[model samples]
Target chain A: MSSAARLSPSAPGLSGTGGHDDRKVPPVADMARIIGLSIPVACMPDVVANTALLHGYADLVGSFVLPDDCEPAYEYVP
Target chain B: MTMQGHKAGAALAIAADVRAGHRSAVSVVTDVIADIEARDTRFNSVTRILGPAAVAQAEEVDKAIAAGRDPGPLAGVPFGVKDLFDVRGEVTTAGSIVLRDNLPATRDAVVVERLRAAGAVPVATLNMDEFAYGFSTENAHTGTTRNPHDTARLAGGSSGGSAASVAAGLLPFTLGSDTNGSIRIPSSLCGVWGLKPTYGQMPLGGVYPFVASLDVVGPMADTVEDLRAVYAIMAGGAPVGEPDMGDVRVARLGGWFADNISTELRAGIDAVMAHLGQDRVIELPEVARARASAFLISAAEGGNLHLPRLRRRSMQYDPATRGRLMAGAMLPAATFVQAQRFRRWFRDHVHAALAQADVLVAPTTVGVAPRIDQPSIVVDGKTVSARANLGIFTQPVSLAGLPVLAAPLAVDGLPLGIQLIGAPGGEAKLFAVAAELQRAGLAACRPLEAGYARKDS
Candidate 1:
């Protein structure tokens, strides 16, 4: 078997990955805090569509029934 | 199907034992905790064990049973929740310290409520990648969730902990959310059965969102029957009644699903088909462009949701994830909008394709779990980003919001599974077909026993 067929404790890094070479960047103590809660990359369309869906729903329900948090630009609280 | 061996630790067995007065619910739950404590130290599958609450809940279940009330389907069975999901009285950490001070959730996520109603006890909040971002559960914040078969390798993520916990018998079944294959990848890596119901099959109210459209909640279990039981309760829809298994038909997806898979994966799929004596192979339409479109939408929306946080605390995320999110933030708005339009087009196209087949079959993941510390995957001698590789088979399906079940192939010794994709709202049919596969002995569904690991050379 080739060398790649053998198992290692930690898998090797990619053979040619040069786009972003910031491997030596300083580590942040609170990564989530620094990164902030970004929406998951997979859910963008759903969020946009859902926002529109909620907006359309709001028009029918009127202002009092909807929480201000339900507005078009409401940040998703995880 | 009558309790054949130790591998079949069915909820039915536990219930039977309790009804026969051999043990109490408290005893079963206490033993499950002991099992987790003893085994998890080696597996590191669980992030946090819910000791006190589980014990108290077990006692309450025992009391209800004593009062002669049937405690529903999962009565007194112990299970775990993916940490991203909120549990009342506990902070939904989503595998990061940023939410350490967040107040406890006031209500259980809808799935959690359903499980509780069925008398299943919550054993712990399992680990995951920070905010369920990565495919390999090598959470810089919480440490990686290791595969039960080989501690040195990854437990596929971002539902890595759920799969690991179940694979290690820490919980017989657990709930996980999938956005582009989190639930399925881990389940495949850990050698367990998992289902990602059609989008919105189970309520998504209390779970932390990854990609909202692609995100879905489902169960991961040792066997398809257990998965069926948990899924029935979790779906909160009237039980799919009894599945009509005899009439079930399996379709092998050609096009994208057939290409780009590891040789090992192809071998496994071939073995599953060969064992059945009835195999159908067809070419499927290419899905790469749609997959990329899904990725574009995931990035743009995710970046926008956390734009303020990204701006204020850019240094806090795992460098790998932060860089990706940053790229998303730079994505033009029109591209993001166009991706959605493309999703509609893709969904319509797939719907037309499915009209020719009841369900599409493909490998749940392109390959086995990568080593936990790896930064990328090498497929066909070409290396790809580890995150992107994990979403290979899952994204196209999730983009269309279709239902899929990742069924472990019993004949394969490695942790590999096959994806059975059904039309939207076809979870019931998916489960029935999975059950037939399980009964045929082509797929087996018992949790891996403790201390079972494949040693590396």
Candidate 2:
């Protein structure tokens, strides 16, 4: 398979909309659990704020158009 | 010829003196340690002084010289590394207390080993942002690194200590890692020369990773010559050939790079362009997105690197760094993938721009070092955290993986710097432009005056 094909989202709920839909996304707390991360109460406010900030950046990146041939800049070589 | 007292000479000059038997390597090492010990109290740039080992190494150089064998090109030159680079037998804290219990490195970082082979002694481990996360080197563990020019202001980081020590004349040169402007930002704010060489051009072995794709180690120094020498040694290659100034093409980066700069900085750049007699300006496309892409990528990569540790000891992390990492760790995989895809597009555009011009010049920071008391800069007419926003110009350039030479502009006030950017593996062109600027007196590292460290001064 081509690199872009491998990068395509195959999991349900992760494809098509490009993660821009707010409804499809989980809350920071829920996402933390899904990712196996435990953010403490004192750190939640900052984490939430930071996650919101990243989402803003993510929205900018996701909204851009890319050709089907546009592979990720990173490659894992072993 | 002992180099006693606080002020340090250039690395090349120190090496020459030692090689000529005018000065013993031991004296040079002892003098630098003493100067850093006596003077660093004001700036707090050094985290740990490698006194005994440095002196011992210097003695070896002197012994080699006495035996009529060449030590190396950088023989007897004393330098420091950002706390992240492993210095054999020293624990690499990476400016965090969490790693205090980690076992010492059994060997030196690859670049440090190369420098040692060239006869340079590692004198100290410098301060930095925790895990190289932030631009400001206000560490929760090691304390802040003050600018040598004005102790009241910040020395832009995560290479703050590296730049500050060089600017303060305590060390001839220092090693720093630039992921997204760690080397350039501090070098600019502190009034010194620094090079963030072509990404992946230098070895990374034993160097702590931060955003693996973006992380590159380079030197910050008192002069372009010194920066070039240290870079050549670290790269394990002969020095880059002298660039033919007549053949080098140069242009200013407009649009995104042109915005958010101070009036004096604009004038300084204008003067440089006038000196070069170049009028062309190349504006990059989608720089905001490029910077945003770098941010998202760094957050995700950095967060993932520390996820395991964050799971067990998040509380021990710098409060400022942990939250960002946790948030990054949870970023939707789609976001990270998108950023990488966009990066490919941006890199192509940058390479296309390089095809038209051999070098591109941009402001390293929007202005001089922001005062420590008011750690903020006005960007897009809004006051933003200087710690995060300082890399406005630098972060975008990093995404493309090109080499950048941060040159300090000669000004009577605090230091301002400009980035002389080049195509990948095109450091020679950047060096030529920087040398021309230096020769014209438009760019030079402003030396701190004697007794400037005193509070009353």
Q: Report the number of the highest-TM-score candidate.
A: 2
Error of 2 at B18 (Å): 0.5
Residue-wise C-alpha lDDT for candidate 2, range B343-429, written one tens digit per residue: 999988898998899999999999989999999998877787898789989999999989999999988688999999998999888
**True contacts reproduced, candidate 2:** 0.77
Q: Work out the iRMS of candidate 2.
A: 7.6
Candidate 2 Cα deviation (angstroms), residue A20: 17
Residues B1-457, candidate 1: write the lDDT tens digits: 1112233446655655555556677778877777778888877778887888888988888787788887766777778899988888899988877677889999899889988988888888898888777788877787878887778788889888899988776677888888888898898888788998887667888888767656788898877777878888887855676446555556687766776687777877776666545476654443654566556667766666657766666566765566556555555555555556556655666777777766678888777778766757765466766765777778777777888989877754567789988888777788877776777776765455632111112
lDDT (Cα) of model 1: 0.69
TM-score per prediction, in order, is 0.81, 0.92
Interface RMSD for every prediction, one decimal?
Answer: 15.4, 7.6
TM-score of 2: 0.92
User: What residue runs in model 1 are displaced by over 4 Å at the alpha carbon?
Assistant: A1-78, B1-9, B274-278, B282-286, B373-375, B450-457
